[model samples]
Target: MATPSAIGIVVSDMKKALAFYRLLGLEIPEPAEGEDHVGITLPGGMQLMWDTEELIKSFDPDWTRPIGTRVGLGFECTSPAEVNALHAQAIAAGYESHKDPWDAFWDQRYAQLRDPDGTVVDLFAATP
Candidate 1:
């Protein structure tokens, strides 16, 4: 079976991007805050990476930051209320909400938000 590895995100400002992810509970090293690239291994051994726009261009000169949410990240909260709380926390910290928490037909509490780079991040909990 082919296993998923890392997710790479190219950002214009490495500092802000690292800060945003750190706010979400990911541990980002202080020194990496100013680096051109940074990454961390998640629980399942999946790596989440961030690279400066300039770093990406070194390989793909025509690369551009894609607009809109073509790909997204999903977070599972411990409870339905936690989903709402975390969503609100993210918003309070200045991230934009894409959708407010709602009981979805799929029997889950769901919400969406745009990260610093405009990537959609989903928060959910099993509601039923």
Candidate 2:
């Protein structure tokens, strides 16, 4: 069976994107001059890659950034405190918190924030 692997994200600027993910406590590999990309190891060993426009355009010529609209990427955490901590980290890293971390009606602690490219990331912790 084929195992699930990395998710790639296209970013307008590599430097800004790198810094943002670094603030999330990911170990970013040193970028190579011609690479225009960086990878981060998520909590569960899943990898996430950030690609520059030039690199992404090579894959999909029509690819473009979504502006003025929310496209969220949800990340599940082990606990509510973990969710709140990540939300705090994002806010401290100079990003605006779209929603303060709070217990959801559906029994989860959740919060949202926007990345440099306008991508919203949802941090969620399941509550029993």
Candidate 3:
């Protein structure tokens, strides 16, 4: 039987991204001294490896440069307040909001933001 493994997000600045995730309450494992990458363990043993261009380009010949895009990652929360709080935090951190936090007909409070690198991040909090 085949199973899904871990997911990796390539980052230009590992330290900054690690700190951002840490702000979201994800436990970032200690980086090996002087290492360019960091490992974070997600629930269910999923490992997210933050890799640098030098590392990824080592494997691919056509490796260009790292670029953040409008396309973003999504996260789920427990309550609308949590979503609103995260939106506020992201905005306060200089992220531009694509959508203000509001309840959706789909039964969640949802909002969007652009990360430091311009990656769009969507946060949704489920309703009771």
The sequence of per-residue lDDT tens digits that candidate 3 reaches over residues 1-128 is: 11223455777777777788889998887677656657766788755667766665654456566455312366766678888888888788877987788777658787767667666566776688
Q: Can you list the residue pairs that collide in candidate 3?
A: none
Runs of candidate 2 exceeding 4 Å displacement: 1-3, 68-128
Note the Cα lDDT for every prediction shown. 0.74, 0.71, 0.68
Model 3 CA lDDT for position 44: 88
Write candidate 2's Cα lDDT for 1-128 as tens digits: 11234466767878877778789877887687667767777888776877787874664466566665422366777788888888888799899876788887658887778778766566777787
Could you give candidate 1's per-residue lDDT for residues 1-128 as a string of tens digits?
Answer: 11234566778887877888899999978753357868888998877877787875664476567775324466777889888899899899999997788887658887878889777676878886
Weakest 10 consecutive residues of candidate 2 by summed lDDT: 1-10
How close is every model to the real structure, measured as TM-score? 0.50, 0.46, 0.47
Better candidate number, 1 or 2, judged by TM-score: 1
Better of 1 and 3 by lDDT: 1
Candidate scoring better on TM-score of 1 and 3? 1
TM-score of 2: 0.46
lDDT of 3 at 107: 83
Instruction: Note the clash tally of each candidate.
Output: 0, 0, 0
Question: TM-score of the candidate numbered 1?
Answer: 0.50
Where does candidate 1 stray beyond 4 Å?
32-34, 70-128
* C-alpha RMSD of each candidate structure in angstroms: 13.1, 12.6, 13.1
